[model samples]
Target: MSQPQAGRGTFITFEGIDGSGKSTQARLLAEHLRAQGHDVILTREPGGSPGAEEIRALVLQGDPDRWSAETEILLFTAARRDHLERTINPALAVGKIVVCDRFADSTRMYQGLSRGDLRATVDQLHSLMIGREPDLTVLIDMDPDTGHARAKSRQTAEERFEDFGANLQAQMRAGFLSLAQEFPERFRIIDGARAIDSVATDVAQTVSTHLSSVG
Candidate 1:
């Protein structure tokens, strides 16, 4: 889909390695913004709208080898397209802030970093199908060991990605940081090892600063 027109709304996405508290932080930021009197919609990738949720199960479940990295990229892009069409675009069109837990970035980190050679393919597919990006991406940065420990504590069918273990998490963390460097204007990297409330406070401040600058 094409990028939203200027002033349509602000799109914010939370991105990080698994267990980096990005999901929780995304939710908290949504609540914080709502309290500030902004209309906000809290959503997630791979499963924001109904059609994409069905795609979510297909990509996230089954064996790790269920799909090749290249195929997985297609699935994620398809899901993202559906999500943008059915949920995100509508929310943004109405001038509501859309806070997403993950976006095309996750596809880049997971498919690109894991598969190594497919990173270029990921970028091309993203440009072809999911060209738009969040106006702000809050990347919660943390050590891989800590992230793995926290991720292991949470049991879910979505353990597929976490199964790659700490080494991959470390690599993905590096990949995420590199992405932040590549997209400095749109990225706000936050130290996620601090207390939850502390991270949330910083996130709020960051969003406030971006909003003010945009206004």
Candidate 2:
């Protein structure tokens, strides 16, 4: 679980089950960093670049079982490849912090363990197509039932995954925790069940500590 080299800029990612407030926290962190005079690019996976966004609609707006697990792995990988090429890489190359809402880890959980025993396939494809990992990953951990309730309240078209119910969400939460253990060097687990600002404070401090350590 060696982290990718720190290159010119830092790459940070937020991970959690749906409605874990990870997206909000990612935005908050980006804004906080920018206010501190850091050059930052706030982006999201499955939709960072034009091409990836198109693929995002296809995968996120369909039936719960719209695509097979194998198909999803391919689609996610393709979108990630496009995102890396068109958005993430260039920003990092120019020494700007890239804060992504989600990354390959999502695919690894959604299409890998949730659907089947495909974690190995996800890793293989990631290694072949998208070789970079985040310099730091902020994982917002939450209770599955609460997260599911929050997600369902959104009423967005991208509720395909949420439709899978809280059971899957529980599985995803466990899977993410396992991933944190697997990649301890880059994963920082934060409690997402608290108040929004409180969680954001923890996230900010976690990232601040990571940046200082890396520098």
lDDT of each: 0.90, 0.93
TM-score of 2: 0.97
Clash pairs, model 2 backbone = none
lDDT of 1: 0.90
User: What clash count does candidate 2 reach?
Assistant: 0
Indicate the worst ten consecutive residues by lDDT in candidate 1: 1-10
- Residue 188 local lDDT, model 1: 97
Backbone clash total, candidate 1: 0
lDDT of 1 at 202: 99
Q: Write the per-residue lDDT of candidate 1 for residues 1-215, one digit (tens) a residue.
A: 46533348899999998899999999999999999999999999879999999999998877878988888988998888888888898898889999999999888889987766788998898787767888999999999999998997998888777887889899899999999999999999999999999999999999999999887
* Clash tally, candidates in order: 0, 0
How do all models score by TM-score?
Answer: 0.96, 0.97
For model 2, the run of ten residues with the poorest summed lDDT: 1-10
What is the lDDT, from 0 to 100, of the residue 142 in candidate 1?
A: 93
- Identify the runs in model 2 with alpha carbons over 4 angstroms from their true place: 1-7
